[model samples]
Target chain A: GAGVSQTPSNKVTEKGKYVELRCDPISGHTALYWYRQSLGQGPEFLIYFQGTGAADDSGLPNDRFFAVRPEGSVSTLKIQRTERGDSAVYLCASSPLPGTDTQYFGPGTRLTVL
Target chain B: QQQVKQSPQSLIVQKGGIPIINCAYENTAFDYFPWYQQFPGKGPALLIAIRPDVSEKKEGRFTISFNKSAKQFSLHIMDSQPGDSATYFCAASNYGQNFVFGPGTRLSVLP
Candidate 1:
């Protein structure tokens, strides 16, 4: 009965550098989602995966942001040419299935672009 | 334009008192509403959720009151404790779609 987990609790990188954030959803979960939370603001949707395939990715900010969940269990969020504006807490969540209302969330990774 | 709007950027209440937070959404397509609680340096946790079909739902001291006609909903925490101090976010989304979160309200419960 493990909850969702994320890697690199905190990350600091220089502008223009690349970064990758990983997420491990709860066992048996079929749906995954990614979000970004800036200081003093609510989380902003980034991408979502229904299985091995991404079901909804319209929330991705730009072409530089991408995610992959090849196995349908674990996911990784990749960012290219990181900018200061991208600094925020990257959150991952999972639900038992797509369309489920309640989602379990991970601690999240704080990315800082200096 | 923000799809979901929450009132009172912050609130302070004494222990055992009730604190109410309200949210309104512009999109009629939304059918699910959920409330999440988060502490500093941590991700949000689901506190409670409600569907448009029901007018109100209660779990323990947490209650969600929904108004389908006005497109508004509110969360009322009865007998709040100091440990309840944190940020609360109200979110709305259609089934199987991405969620839209409000700016959030910071609640402070004094012992």
Candidate 2:
């Protein structure tokens, strides 16, 4: 794809249900990131991946939240036992290199937990 | 602690006026500062960026002002237009670190 792409533009689920959000990064991008944005707030870092390894997962709120970049090109963010507080927009971004300053963002998936 | 802090949660300006949004950072290791603009439903797009070595950088109607000493930076929109009404975010990052974003400022350009 010419740009990053996210699946399920909008997802509405009930509390305690499990959900998965997928991201397809730009071709050949070696770095991928996941962020969450609440209403009226900026995106907050959730995790980062370098190749197939998670270089940094410190930002994940808890064990219920996990992300995997299986082949280093596409990634998936999984949430278990979702709560109402989990409602927010999930953003995916990618860069050519790990330390690159610029990251191209996808349209983002708006997740609503009722 | 919020690594990056932005002020004036919201700002309203006339179409032809200039709108300034300020941000301050606590980490001195940050080397790159970038501003992003986002409309209601779209993802943020990079507007302009500045490095610590340069005090200022301008691109078209958008300019970034950097203050290394005070650990502050600001975005100045020149000749603001109604189309420019959007939420602006200031972000900072050092090598190998995740980009940290400020709270963000919502700007409204009144025509």
Candidate 3:
């Protein structure tokens, strides 16, 4: 693709429902990342994947939040038992090699949990 | 703890004026500093970037002033315009690591 792509630009789900958001990164990019942004706040890092392995998942808030990159090209973020507090914009970004290279971000998925 | 801190949750600037956004970081290991601009319903895009070795870098109307000793950096927009109104984020990163972003500052340029 020309740029990173995210699925379900907007999602509305009731509390306790399970939701999955997908991200397709640029072709052959070695690194991919996920972030969450709340109203009036900066994007918070959620997790980062280097190739087929998750190099850093320290930013994952809790057990309820999980992400995976099986083939090193596409990734998925899963939220279990979503709560109202989980409502926020989920962003996905990709970089060539996860170093000094710039990251291209997707349009983001705005999840509204009520 | 937040690795980077930004100031002025919101800023209002008049047309033709210069708007400056400041950021400070505690991590000395960060060598790459970049600023991103984001519009409503859009993802953040790289506006400019600077390396630790350079004290300042300018690209047209945008300039980045870096103070390596103070662990601080700032973005200056010259001749601000209404179209420039958006949210700006400052971020820092070390080699092969995740970029840490500041809280972000909203800039509104009134025509």
Candidate with the greatest TM-score versus the true structure: 1
Model 1 Cα lDDT, one tens digit per residue, A23-96: 99999999999999999999999988999999999999999999999989999999999999999999999999
Q: Which has the higher DockQ value, candidate number 1 or candidate number 3?
A: 1
Reference-based lDDT, residue B91, model 1: 96
For candidate 3, list the clashing residue pairs, or say none. Answer: none
The residue pairs in collision within model 2 are none
The docking category that best describes candidate 3 is medium
TM for candidate 2 is 0.97
Give candidates' CA RMSD values in order: 0.9, 1.1, 1.2
* Model 2: DockQ vs. true structure: 0.74
Write down the lDDT of every candidate, Cα atoms only.
Answer: 0.94, 0.94, 0.92
Model 1: runs farther than 4 Å from truth?
none
DockQ for the candidate 1 complex? 0.82
TM-score winner between 1 and 2, please give it. 1
Query: TM-score of chain A for each candidate?
Result: 0.98, 0.98, 0.96
Say which docking band candidate 1 falls in. Answer: high
Quick one: ranking by DockQ, best first?
A: 1, 2, 3
| Residue A76 local lDDT, model 3 | 98
